[model samples]
Target: MIKETFSKNTRINKKVCLTTDFVIAGGGLAGVCAAITAARAGTKVILVQDRPVLGGNASSEVRIWALGATSHMGNNNRWSREGGVIDEIMLENLKTNKDGNPLYFDAILLDKVSAEQNITLLLNTAAYQVNKSLDTKIDSIDAFCSQNSTHYTISAPLFCDATGDGLVGFNAGASFRIGAESREEFGELLASEDESNQILGHTLFFYSKKVDHAVTYKAPSFAYSHEEIGANPRSKNIHGHDSGVKFWWVEYGGIRDTIYETEEIKWELWKIVYGIWDYIKNSGQFEDVDNLTLEWVGTVPGKRESRRFNGEYMLKQQDVVEQTNFYDAISFGGWAIDIHPSEGIYSEKPACSQFHSKGVYQIPYRCFVSKDIDNLYFAGRNISATHMAYGSTRVMITCAHGGQAVGEAAAMCKDLSVSPKDLLEKELIHQLQQRLNRFGHGIPGVALDKSANKVSFANIFASSELVLKNYESCGDYVSLAQSAAQLIPLKKGNAPIVSINIIAERDTEIVCQLRTSEKPENYTPDIINKTISLPVHAGKQTIEFDFTDVDVIDQYGFVCFLANQYIQLEISTQLVSGTMSVFNKVHKAVSNSGRQEAPANSGIEEFEFWTPERRPKGQNLAVSFDPPLPAFSKDNVVNGHLRPWLNSNAWVSDYADTQPTLKITWQEKVELSEITLFFDTDYDHALETVLMQHPESEMPYCVKSYRIRTAEGKLLADVNNNYQTVNTLTLDSSITSQELIIELDHPSSDVPAALFEIQVR
Candidate 1:
């Protein structure tokens, strides 16, 4: 509710006092995402951001890529896109700003906030003062927006401090920690040996663009001379930059109080930004830069660390290394522990340290709520994490996930009239998980409760047999004499295999077979089902083997092939999971040099071969299946699985244009008010903006248009051109029907039509 208030000078001026369900501070991804989440759940929210635009560091002002599991494609995290608002923003960025303009992202963030009617956005409004009663509950927060010259006080039942520096929590006297912890504090290996006031400093980045004509540069008075730009290794790699955010190493002010000394830090960063560019343009150390000119430089420092709010669960470095699964897990983080030097660019030994996880790890809800402050919750870089663990969770997308969980928790609090800590109960936690799952947020170990699904057992789907696939790839692998043959693992399922094709590129004939693994733990082929010799004298050969009657053994099978003198494997990088590509390599004793096999001059036969390298998992192949069992199965949908099924989890269509239909027939007429569907939109298929730009389009094999029908062919509704993170249909009145049919439309992209999740409530 908005109200007009009067101060001592009541004649003219107006003071605004806004009452809301949740008052969120900071307009970064965490705060914005939290506001959106709560607003979507029908909660009144007031989101105050000090910056003129939203997205904080992600805005045009800071231009940091929204990094998360997709750390700009830096590591081996497969199928790592967190499926929620963040995924939507990522895909939207690809669709609109393919060039990755920082200016364009500002508009995206603005659109997201304005789309929700329940959200009141106060941009350029900084929340600085908080009022707490003797009971220690927050009463109101005082904020000032210079743009409108308005003195406002926002009061709410709940509040979140996503300020990156935990401004609201700090003002409220919440328990928090800053800088690195002593080694004795948490047994953290990365902790400083002795307590110290040091942290990862703020960095300033500059962008350069090339123009048609030659551009000249004269160094600014404050810019460092070439001699002053000394031997920092970052300068060595600074010439002829392409990306706008190349100089992340240009930083200062970690040794000082980062929050209090930001002005000094920004000045230092600006000097370095100018000095680096001056050295590039006028120092004569750069070449091919005649057309390059300075574009944009950050005026304010991009902060890396500040006040760390203490939450119920303090996530230490061991929690990261152990990959602990929390019972109340709300979000997951997979980025490496990237610890930067306190001195930043001036450090002689590399600028940053990194340690990667075996896979993604879970973060608990207890980590987002304050330990001392009763109603205090925070997200972004200030959440409950030790200094060492904060290095990984501080990234924007992971922080966005934390914001998402907070938003949902706030809504739950409103409904139950409980605090953030109260939701930790097993039942309430499960309720939160279910609500999040309904929105398709992937919780690490939580599966959607299947009892709520509309389909029980009667609905039957018959089309081309759907087969579950463990991998996806568009490339081919050919046999190599020196490297050994490719061994593709095929896991046994309920459905029998029809036929499989192998792409071979060799002029010489080779022997291949459907072999079983020596053991589940080992990759070596043990037993053979059928051995066949194929003539491979061509540019490319398609070898097919029918497995309609093959007997399986040990729950696994490998497609093993003999090699030729020279061969090349065609592999697809467009996929996430598929059959593993195996090869054997031999390395020298004292050196890093290695070979596929022993030299030909050796007396002993060069027969020693190892498994293939684990770089590329997706191998291109055509796998088919026959009629499936349990005519109508829960596996048809409602598995809480996000990825597409290769041979299972869906009903396959044998004939194109046949228009496959999946019908759910209940035991009796049931009331259906809502229906949700998840289709196979390839998350691994990223939109390229910088290197290669493709027109924003739907993923292949995605259902473009579809109709809802009953067993009697009664038309209910029709959906067209559906391209979203998920599809949900809600009706004004409940419909009683014994069956529900979803007629498939031909996919716009080349592939099969797929549905991952179908839920009706």
Candidate 2:
């Protein structure tokens, strides 16, 4: 028997009360990651998802593929493990299914949360109201689900608002701001001279499939007319043609209100999309319309801007540009400034010209916890950030990293039974860094070494002479040698190493001498010289000079010279180069150290050792290198491709030309041992071929291959046949300096061949 209470004319349905150690609001990437992280850390977690599934923007509703920081396709890199729960879900999907579909995403998310013993998930739940104590702490939240006509009262020690909208914070009376701030506030260059409430617009993404034949579309009423839409003012008119076409450019509703206008803008965008398609088809743009169809229409709109909560520290544009490394950094972001215009329905090009920075910058922990609220943490776009700052950190992967940070912070709170503010101390930050490092999260930056008093140059070349130079004027000597060499700066705590890159045909001999201007009379053996011969063929040559033995004096400097040459150098003072060629040529002089950092300058001539020769009209020359390889046998291939119910498709191939060859340089003598062959999964209808070879060995050998496959006859793995479904093979370390060749068998016609990752370790 359930009782309903009527307050005046309103009726409220009562439900069971659930308690947990941590309660996370919003089921988006940030919330889900936070919940999973907290649960994994041995805390009882309650995850309240507003939707039926877990992933927010990346879910089936939005249908955006999960992308990490790495550029490798299909998981070839090891650095893509930022989201632990996301990776687990992907692994499960790859194991059980072969088709890359949206439905599988939902299933995986549900399975992951439901299977976890420490997490309790409540789907189809929306947080409508919050109850706080007199002390300004969140006590409980009241959630409503219309489908069941029920009200849920959730109580937890720590509350996390993973909602991109910062709904929980707004409702809890937490102070926040909207729109762009003036540049004077944060000393940011990208900030608008005048403050404006206008921000970036939201997007309703859709996917269209291309048919075998072309289709035509008819123009709609809202379609930009020739008179209405013309050349944009920001961009140059190329060949007297207007480049403004309504694609992702059509943006609006950021001025009046970011959240309230999102739905209206979404509806308008949908009309534009379908209406444009209709115009294209009917307007005789193409022929054959039978196969053209819409593949997916995003129900969840991608939001670009929203409320930003005030925190202990506000990340500004200056911090990003200056590459400020904070001691309390918890995450890193590398996306460039992607600002949008305020007036047009679609966004205009960014006003400021600069895009990327010197490198990736760090996000501090103080940005995660709120300044006014206690026991409340925020992640994702809702964190403390200026409008310009959010323009870069609002990407999905960056949000995931923020979510991971908050998740770990929540676990620490539960363990210490203290508020997030109390944990902002220095020692705890170091502990957080250590834990994150263990899980492959790179810290902002740390000094490795600092002393310059004991610097000595070793491994000097025999053909060069050493000369004494004024120690305090190292920069002057570096500028003089700009045409052929450059000196890299060392951080306050960094052990300095000098690297020379050969660029020209000259067999250049370089002499380096270290001296102190303060004590000219005291001559110390702190000098070294190196003369390296340029290779006959143009190629890069690297020479490293270790400075571990020199007795460096205060105000010491070093001088470098091109032996028997007198060439002037041109120097430039720019931190980074605009293009790849210039960037590779410009070396990072100073490491990230808290000291009198060197000025950004480039005076030395950048050297290169490799130069290509012009070939005759029709002549082609082929060059190859052969190195010692390893051997393989049956014992190494313990698991065959025909056993234990292989999950997906399997096959083999022996493409001698395509097979990966091994080039080994043995450092010491060793014995031979059995080799092991790893195989890829049969999931996603992927088939692979494996191969092995001894490379013309006369030793009497008995080779045997085994098959470990599923009961359904799908190939699992094979070692002796030199065929493996997996991407990596580990040869026994005992097999030293032996050349082994391996190949894969051709996959079946029905299955597509694919490989993800390979590693010898």
Residue-level lDDT tens digits of model 2 in 386-498? 88778767766567777877887888888888889987899887766655433324443421111210111111111111110101111211222332222211112222334
RMSDs, each prediction? 7.6, 15.9
Off by over 4 Å in 2: 1-11, 65-100, 212-250, 285-290, 344-354, 446-761
Worst 10 residues of 2 by lDDT: 575-584
lDDT of 1: 0.69
RMSD of 1: 7.6
**Alpha-carbon local distance difference test for all models:** 0.69, 0.49
